[model samples]
Target: MKKAVLASALSWALLAGCSQPAQTDQTIHQVNSVTNSSSVSDQTTLTAAQYSEQFIAELWQLYPEYALYVGYYDYDDQLPIANPQRRAQELAWLQQQQATISQLLETDLTDHQRTDLSLMANFVKRGIWQIESFKSWQWDPSEYNVAGGFAQIVNGNYKPEIERLRTILKRLEHVPAYYQAAQANVSKPAIPQTRLAIQQNQGVASVLGDELLAKAIASDMTEAEKIQFEQRLSDAQLAVATYIDFLTELLPEVEGADPVYRLGDTVYEQKFAFDIQSQLTAKQLYERALADQKMIHGKMAELTTELWSTYFADQAMPAEPMAAIGQMLERLSQVHAKPAEFKAAVEQQIPELIAFIKANDLMTLDDDKPLVIRHTPEYMRGYAVASIQAPGPYDAKANTYYNVMPLDGMPAEQAESFLREYNQYLMQVLNIHEAIPGHYTQLVYANKSPSLIKSIIRNGAMIEGWAVFAERMMLEAGYGDFEPELWLMYYKWNLRVVTNTILDYSIQVLGMEQEQAMDLMVNQAFQQQAEAAGKWRRATLSQVQLTSYYAGFSDILVLRDKAKQAWGEDYSIKRFNETFLSYGNAPVPVIAELMLK
Candidate 1:
């Protein structure tokens, strides 16, 4: 699951009835009784699928933020409350439902039916862990930020201005209770998380006071409506401000306390199983990443030697292959975008890349989908260089923002290095991953899937893997001249993903400090100083997430090769991607079973 969306699933209504932690064997038999007894269209199978679908949809109502993300506006006005009591209730209900779903007679369910049930099971397992096991409610302050409650309102125009604002105001009324509960429940706030929450709350206040209400919500309101809107927003600002103050006040108490951010091996591995649903364990994934890292480095070395001969045919070759590769890449760095032109270059290249995809039939081009490029929200920044804040699977018309953070405020040397790393060729690769045929394209198809279960229970590895795969696919499909320079840059980008897996496992599990971590990223992966530094923070703030790109990308590549061997002449990139992604964002292994079998 994407961290933001799942953590955002905080709602009192969502957990209202989860206190019922009991499931009977007969209830389990509904799934058990269905399997080979009927075809997919048979009454029994459809009955089971529909039953599970309804259960999944109803659960969506509990998370309004998630609803908005997915484009379901039914709960737009509601905000989720996070406290010990509600979490306990939600956890219990999840356990009961999970027991019933997990025990469904495997013989009775169709392949698709089993996949949906597995998706549900994954969600329940993660929910149980997040609540009872991880207990982030007690320490992760970012969990309590209501800014997202406001963001959902302003970010989407699924409803008219007045209607959306009214709904937002209704949710805003609960802002105080939401944060108050945060204060109550997060009795031991982690300092790093607390600092982030404070920063995020201030961002919410600015958007609410300086932009949202003043500009959009009350932009053209009647005098009477304006007064009500202003009052509601004024109150929201106070509640958010109060929470920010609490986090700020908490800074002193945590000054000497340990950071306590790593999930440790035990919790992190359990999370990997639920989120990734892969054949490999964390250790296996990390070891594979190490091998893959060396392999990619070797390829880059060979390619750079070719480039070195092209430019310096008269000179003696460097004894070490890495030295030659490093020098060649350094020269390629000069070909990057100027700081001022970085984002625009990315924007300009997208349509060109999409045109290429369509012309080559590499993948289907759905021109109907809407996309935009903009600065990332303050609350969402500090995680990655670029990311897609796409509308959830349910909402198609809403614009999927390709968030590109500006490097202006960064130290001059850092800014230049960051941009150079996102060089002209690399920007196109990043665009391919974050937009076009990457997250945006896959997500658009995911939205159209018959099952919402796949969308809600997003497998991080699958989502990231597809994006990483997309980058390679586009380059192989003949993007940007298929030149040695471009391919070398592409290898660097892939290296970043491979090193990401090794680096994260190294830091969080092996407890490798910054010195060693930096060496792995900079020396081994050849990442920029600025990029490596950002990843260190991101890895600290998150665990098991960075590894998804390598794990998912490599797994899907293996799946594609098998499909190629099996389909023979029928194997086309377009066909494979469509059939594979058609199943939605369930774990790749689940998709593999359905597609490969």
Candidate 2:
């Protein structure tokens, strides 16, 4: 998952969702009535269903942006000010929720209720850790942007144009105060994050610009109302500009300060637990990745030897395994779509994947939900090349976007290197991971999940791991007609996952530097220079996220093996997949416990 603005804890979507909850009559009443632990404690006597509903209501009040993200629109016009007072409030709410969930877990309950309660407890503990221990708000200025929340409202079809515009106008009123609070909260900020804040904020006006203005003007609202909306838009844009200026000016002041981006071993351990939620500890996961790396290299070498003559019949192969595999991949990568045809190629593969899933009876495919392919939004660029923007469970009717970054303006060499990295076979793997039977498919099932807790408190490891698992699963089920080239690229892509764990753990906890990191990616993992450069940048920008792929993928594959043994004659790929995903996006371990039971 791509991080969004204000994701101080875990991924961006995880925390940004908390920043934008809406306010309806029910929410306002809940917020006002539930002022202390006593009020929430009273709800514990209620049934699991009742208590969960009440818990979500209080949660929305605390993290309103999250409410907006999950399709609750009551507080769309409100933006939580990231000031000291608000953090204290969040701390108190989390402690109370933690207490209530602890008590609930002790009660007699069904499997589903227990699973949901456990997830809620995990979510609450993470929030508490964020406030008390991993306090990113104090040093990460990039966590303060407001453009994404507004962009969601502008692009969302949840409300009509005029209504959404009105929400935007009301929310825009707080832009100045929001940044004021942000500026006040930041202290000794990380220089790298400060620079990123400047770049991300520079595009804030896109969401508040002509497209929104045109909608407001065309709406049936009064002329005076339209004028008022335009004025607010201008102010919001200026607030964004002012915030960018603040970050730009603050850069030099902190350039020579301590390098605080590295979350040392102590904090890294705790963060990995909360974010990945895996059965293994950080050290164990790192060790497993190291072993997987050697094994994948061996597999890639075998494929390279088999295909060497097919691509280079007249040439002699390198004596070293890494060199031989690298040369073979370089030849295979030459066959790729042009930069202009990148997005079109991705778009064209969606239906093919859907058909394969149906023909093979892999899993049930939902046709009602539409997947819209588009360019990555301006404010969300500078991170990953592609991501999925799925509507929250509450707004299931809204379109799910497959966000591909356009290569239109990239330098020609950079674009070619990128295209070669994606290549033809790997591009199909990318589609499988990002679109059909991956994020888009998995997320659609999440929204349909009956348990609200499972759908909303999504685990990044499971989310990412499922995508990685889907890639391997598709190929094994006869995707690309069992081509060795596709398998070679698949192994190469899988190596990326293994090295991602190694790169992240080594850098954040073990003090790995740029040169060593590049050697691992380009020379060892066989990634192109362009792809390696992006991963290096991304590794610095995030922590524990890159590791999610291997952590989750390995855990999931192990779980499936146990299921096969336990289910015996009843085990089938479709049966295993549907049952696994049925738990929504709960952590892999949690899902495993429930599944194996």
Candidate 3:
């Protein structure tokens, strides 16, 4: 799966907002000052921009980990405890923020400020819905892990090593209480989430283990501070271990509820609304995907026929479109990186992609931001084979990691299947979608956005859509010198995007079984066995996320066409791209409304 971007902790990762200062006195005082003085009626006195800043600070107090991930360190030492008291606090805060935003939206404001305010309003509403209605915190144990947040601090370079270590030492104080609250809050846990929680927690050693201790020992901390740090780290490790044990024990007991990973139609639809924030509804997106799938299949068949003589001159072309296409794909799939060489292959393509973008003058490429291709973190594994971990909007200078899962230890047959799925041509498309002018590039632009509201309250459809759009844009610009083979493979890659919408909607809402889903992906979508299986696992583990690719891609394509006609002779791809991206990672429909105006 070409999943991109890990936004710190997953609980409120999508709801980007605020972070506290590193100093406790200042952080508390600033937050308290805002809360004590600010009210909905008072919000009308402040400009939207000023109110937004205040609201973000209050949100940071609620979700310190999210702030830390986004490069705000004020709440570095704090971790939220998932109990009724905290939930109630979150609900109250969101309600107040929602009312304040609604009042602000009624007053006069700049278009930019208005957009930001609207995004903040939506984010507040989503948070309220998540607590009062969606309530994943009550059922999803995987939502409770602290490892990713800690890893963000330890692995991050926003501060000096010693300073970060001190922050970590302070944060460790909350670990035991956080887990205890997690244990109390979860009820009727989904089996998949329980297993994922255990699996992810096993990675706590990566952060709190001897390596961190070694760093502290080598640092400039005083002896007393070092001892205190050591004790806290040990306790934090025990807390994580205990949480894992609790989950392991609870797994079999929850089987009686016939626990499911799939959220039904009603829940899935609402999540799509909040998570995607697209102009089209989930059902509308699914219908478009079905139509798109047929169109892509027709094109693939035409390409297959065109290429048959080149690869299979010795044999007759099959009368059936699918059979011909499948055979051609099998032939092309033979060209792939060896399991050991996969990461190296991706690394090598970075420069090639950069050259292509610049040569074509697709858009301005930032040379300052570094892209690092590395092994997928242990804590983040089992979901996607490759993903991008870009620095949050606050920390743009941090490395944007292109996390590629190593193929080591996979059974030979499985590894071969996997490689075939990500074959040579499709791999290039994946890079375009996940790196270069895809997620990494888009996120960098997102951070540069003047509006923090837009940056933090990011729309998944806009983010994923741009990456999907990047795939086709790069190809159309003649990246592969118009190779029919490359174009044929590109069609297959596009099929993955289209089918992702179909697969997600089908499984989550329509109850698609494994056999039917495999047939849809492997046979109809032309995915390899390994890729299809991994996607099926991903579909079950997630809701609404799979649909983002198609949702965003379709929205972007439509918007670009509109921009062409609206701008007329003024239109240029570079202008459209930069202008569209300038709005930060706001939803495509919002950007379209602005640009087409």
Q: Which portions of model 1 show Cα errors greater than 4 Å?
A: 1-46, 215-225, 252-260, 313-315
Please report, in order, the local distance difference test score of every candidate based on alpha carbons. 0.71, 0.81, 0.80
**Which whole-number lDDT from 0 to 100 does residue 357 have in model 3?**
88
Higher TM-score: candidate 1 or 3? 3
User: Model 1, range 39-96, lDDT digits (tens) per residue?
Assistant: 2223333355665765655465444455666677776666666555455545555656
What would the per-residue lDDT of candidate 3 be over residues 52-170, giving only the tens digit for each residue? 88777676775676677677777776766666655655566677787788888899988888888888877878877877787777777777667677788888887799998998888
lDDT of 2 by residue, 146-176 (tens): 8777877888888788888788777877777
Find the 10 residues in a row with the least total lDDT in model 3: 17-26
Scanning candidate 2 in windows of ten residues, the lowest lDDT window is: 17-26
TM-score of each: 0.90, 0.95, 0.94
Off by over 4 Å in 3: 1-4, 7-11, 16-41, 253-259
Cα misplacement distance, residue 71 of candidate 2 (Å): 1.4
Worst 10 residues of 1 by lDDT: 17-26
